[model samples]
Target: MAAFGQRKAQRLARADASRKGGLDERAAPVVQLLNGRARFCTTSSCSGRLVLAQGSAADANSWEVQKKNCTWLMVTHETCTKDDVMTALEKATGDVVLKFEPFVLHVLCQELQDAQLLAVRSTHCLEVPLSHKGKLMVSEEYIEFLIHVANRKMEENTRRIDRFYKCLEVALKTAISANNSPSQETENRSVYIHRRKRKTIQEQDVHTSLKDHNEELEPEDDTESNLAIFAEIMI
Candidate 1:
């Protein structure tokens, strides 16, 4: 566990450096592997989707560059609440958790965004029983996967917000169109003059013709657009 902490500290430093645009391709994988969670299954060989950490972001973030790196790592956190982690060992069902390499635990948690929206079903942190084989060595690949999952979730949220805006915007446009009806009023460039109904047959005919002409320029109904308006900007 001492070794895991040391390596995790190293990865955090690396990630912090990377966040600051210090891109070292080789160093990156090492950081992620040593500091990230690898999915595991207790009952079956095939693990579920997510391999989120057992405790906090720090726990989830640190992973082993090689299995040897975290072999000595152990769980020490006493406060494992379900809100941010999974600590079934202590009767705590925290979602965000990290499994020490020695223990295999099953835990249910909500995605970082919404617990209700997504059921992150991956093993919390499977401490590979020395007997349990099959990729006992944590790989940097899982780190990449974690990043992808986070990005996809963020994009989904952005799209949802965009759809909401589009729906609202379309409604607003419809309302405006209804109120200042284009048909009844004339276009500014080609002004429409609303006149009283004339008693004379010729005058009435002219008035009727003008109304018909104005109706033609009423413009297409500002209504539903099938495509989502991704950029809803109100200026």
Candidate 2:
């Protein structure tokens, strides 16, 4: 446990080692929230992005475009326009691909249980081959369509990020509440029971008042003639 804490501290100290040299604005809050907890820390994350890159046609098996050999014509974290795509296409010399990368996050948890609390998943990014050997494979209209699709994907990515943040916030709060000391837990339980009893009493009072009101509305039969019949029956 001590070793893990030490390693986590060391890694977090240098967490901002990405090309941007900082955490992405959209992902910063979530990263901070996780890192604030004792059992979890974020290793890396990207809120989502659109990228136009030039890569070799022969490297079809590669999972990612090699940064060393590939050229990044354009990169944006926000939705882009068709003109942006065209401008980026002009710089492509090899196989070019336009990509809409969705929200991704990597978290390191101290225990498997801690990791299991996070169930959010991101959609796989979309990749469209735009150019082959400096020749545009698709028409301008098609590029516009691709841009529209990417923009829509970006909007969905933002929504997912928001949801993930909300769910994680709730899960972390529940975990923390569960870890409270015995005395605190008892106090909380007592408060809850007290509130519940108060509510029940209030409801009962309302019911009694309503019943009384209804009884008052009923016609009262105050006939002395019925008293004589009752006495005769008793006799």
In the range 1-235, model 1's lDDT, one tens digit per residue, is 4554554444344433211244233223322321243221111111111223322222333433232222222222122223222222233222222332211122222122222222323222332221112122233455334444444443443344344336534654564466488764544313312111112345457668979878543442335211211121110
- Compose the digit string of candidate 2's lDDT tens values, residues 1-235: 8877898999888847676677788998888899998888789988899999898877645535677878789999999999999988998778898998898889888988798898666555798888887889999999999999999999988888888889889988988878777877887677666665665687578769979878543442557535643453344
The lDDT per prediction is 0.31, 0.82
| Lowest summed lDDT window (length 10), candidate 1 | 40-49
Top candidate when judged by TM-score against the true structure = 2
Query: Could you tell me the TM-score of candidate 2?
Result: 0.72
Query: Distance (Å) between predicted and true CA of 132, model 1?
Result: 18
Q: Give the local distance difference test score of model 2.
A: 0.82
